[model samples]
Target: MAELRLEELTAQTIVAARNLALKPGQAAFIAPETYVHVEQDLDPAGSWPRVVMDGDHLVGYVMGAFDADATEDFLKAALWRVHVEADAQGAGVGRFAVQALADEARRRGFDRLTVVWASGEAGPEEFFKAVGFEVVGETPYGENLGALAL
Candidate 1:
């Protein structure tokens, strides 16, 4: 029962969480591609969100960004590069993190939030469904786009 908190991801924490992600086979993360943009993204919109700390240990990371530029009336949000350390995976931390992100999205007046999970990693799809996301579509190589109305 670890209580979760949302914190900006420091460069150090990004590396730590990246290391954690790399250790697990088949659990690849988009972080390797997008982490460099964190500070800039956070600065502009205050929404390159990350979650940190499980009693002072960094257990995971998530980034949520809005797609206001899209023509769709509902504000689009993307939940990216999310991964929890192996030991913390089944301990409810992921769910808590999702809830936190959803809370943030709602606060920001987003109409919907989407989690694009790397495919064949059905665990996340199940996790998303558990927390109220509906499958909108799939991406190549089995990645999925799941959405939740805020």
Candidate 2:
């Protein structure tokens, strides 16, 4: 495999990103009902989204949110979403994208980066755990809330 790289979502790549194919039963893991956002997060400055590329191929996409003024600690700096192509699942694309988000959080001076995920078969609990996010709590919607201290 070529070295994986991150790219800003561009007009040219957006279509490919939107078409990223996940393995069967994996789509539900990336977007749990408990994911939260406020009007303030609408600012482009607060949302950090990147597309993962292995040479010319769009292998994955990841997004994170940074809201210093958020009332909840977990919301302050959170990993919003990550979606990797089915074929790239075990090739480190997901981990690479997540670390990039954590790197951004560290750059912004956040002490931790949080994420929420639904638990079940084909879910990302194991992946998030392997990335060093601990289960800190549960959301009102019954999803697991995880945090990785930087």
Candidate 3:
């Protein structure tokens, strides 16, 4: 396994980031004005957005906030989007990213964090479960909303 480094994203990095993460059906959850804008200008002192970059490639990312608008302090968060290309899946990258998000949230005073995963996607539910996130709710697409206690 290569050393996976986590870093803050800037505006210049967003396009290449899309290459690593967004693949057709994977954009709805994380693609929007608010989410990308924040990542484009990461604020270490204010906002919580982090990316897992494998060398020069963006493998996965996690963003946390209190509300769906990503602006409250109730501290509810979404894994938003997490991907590692085809060859990288099941090679420990997703698990590592999830744990990284959990660690980040815990370090930031959040007691729990939520991840809304694609329901039809194979292996993700079990992966989240293996990471200690349990299904607490469901979405229209049968997507299981899982939560991990930080």
Candidate 4:
């Protein structure tokens, strides 16, 4: 297995992160543009956006939140968005990235990590479940809400 790492998203990596592309049929799950827009809108105090790296190569991107003061309905440490590049999917990159996010949440004193994905999407529900998340509920927008107790 390759060593998977998460690097803090910085000005130097933003362009590469924004250029990551999802596989066919996967775009409905999340958009790269959303990651860029969210990164722009949320101050560093409210979000931690990271570039997923395999060795020195940028392979994906993920955004998470640790802000206990967040006014949004999501109170726990949540994985706001994650996307593995089209070429890197199914090589355990997604698994490693989620596990890394969970580890980060644990480091922040969080006991759980929450994520929401489009319920109607094909792959995400199974991918999340395979990584130890359980379907807990549905978001008001009908997304599948899941939790992993770290």
Candidate 5:
């Protein structure tokens, strides 16, 4: 496994983050410019947009929020989006990224980290479960909701 690190999104890295790609058919799991658009709407006090790196390479992207009101009553933080470049998938980057996000949530006084993924996506379902997130419910649009108690 490569050494994975999560760094706060900076202007220099934002372009690389936007260019991170998913494998074909995996785009349905997340929108193509989510990082770009979400950054524009971030509330600095509660949202964290990070660029996931493997040494010097930009390999993934993640955005999470600690906005209590934006999540369900039981959640204290939410992992909004996570994407690993197709070449980096299955090499532990995603696991490292999610764990880093969970650590951030804990540091922010959150006891749980929640996430939602397209319901029918086998990859995300398995990935979340492998990282200790249990199926909690479903979203209005039919996304599978999962939560990890920190």
Candidate 6:
């Protein structure tokens, strides 16, 4: 394993973060339609976006949104997006990224962090659960709502 560190997503790293690869059948679980149903309504002010670096190489991206007043549970201190390169999957990149996000949430006075996933083969349901998020409920759109207590 290379040295893993989290960096604030900056202009210089934006392209690399956006280009992070995913395993086959993982595209359908990405934001704007599937797992992250809260993407369109996210407030930029509360967004905490970060990139995971493994010795100068971009390996993953994790985005969290913090909104204390969000009516939907998943929108508050939410796990907005997480994308890890296919080759790096299951090697702790995603877990490292999410732990950073959860730390940020704790700093912002949140007692928990929430995430939703589109359930199906190849979806990220197992990873989210393994990271300590329990299925709290289901979204109206049928996404699994998971909460990780901070």
lDDT minimum window of 10 residues, candidate 1: 31-40
Q: Point out the worst 10-residue segment of candidate 4 by lDDT.
A: 31-40
Please give, for residues 1-150, the per-residue lDDT of candidate 5 as tens digits.
Answer: 467788888898999888887888787777323333334444568778898888899999988877766424423487878889999999988898899999989988889898767655435778889999998887665566789999
Q: How well does candidate 4 score on lDDT at residue 48?
A: 75
**What's the true lDDT of residue 33 in model 4?**
33
- Candidate 5, position 129, lDDT: 93
Q: Which lDDT tens digits does candidate 2 get at residues 7-41?
A: 99899888998889998998767677766434344
Candidate that scores best on TM-score: 2
lDDT (10s digit) by residue, model 6, range 51-119 = 898897899988888889887767888888899999889899889999999999999999999887888
| Candidate models: Cα lDDT each | 0.66, 0.87, 0.62, 0.76, 0.77, 0.85
63-138 in candidate 4: lDDT tens per residue?
Answer: 8877665554444588877888888988988888888888988998888898777754455878888999998987
Per-prediction TM-score to the true structure, in the order listed: 0.74, 0.93, 0.68, 0.83, 0.84, 0.93
Q: What tens-digit string does per-residue lDDT give for candidate 3 at 1-150? A: 678877777885565555664445544544433344344433334445667778876776655544433443222555655666655666777788778877876776767887666554443667778878888876545556678877
Error of 4 at 78 (Å): 0.4
**Candidate ranking (lDDT, best to worst):** 2, 6, 5, 4, 1, 3
Stretches of candidate 6 above 4 Å error? 32-38
- How many pairs collide in each candidate, listed in order? 1, 0, 0, 0, 0, 0
- State, as a TM-score between 0 and 1, how close model 3 is to the true structure: 0.68
Error of 3 at 5 (Å): 1.2
RMSD of each: 4.3, 1.6, 5.3, 3.3, 3.6, 1.6
Candidate 4, position 30, lDDT: 75
Q: Cα RMSD for candidate 4? A: 3.3
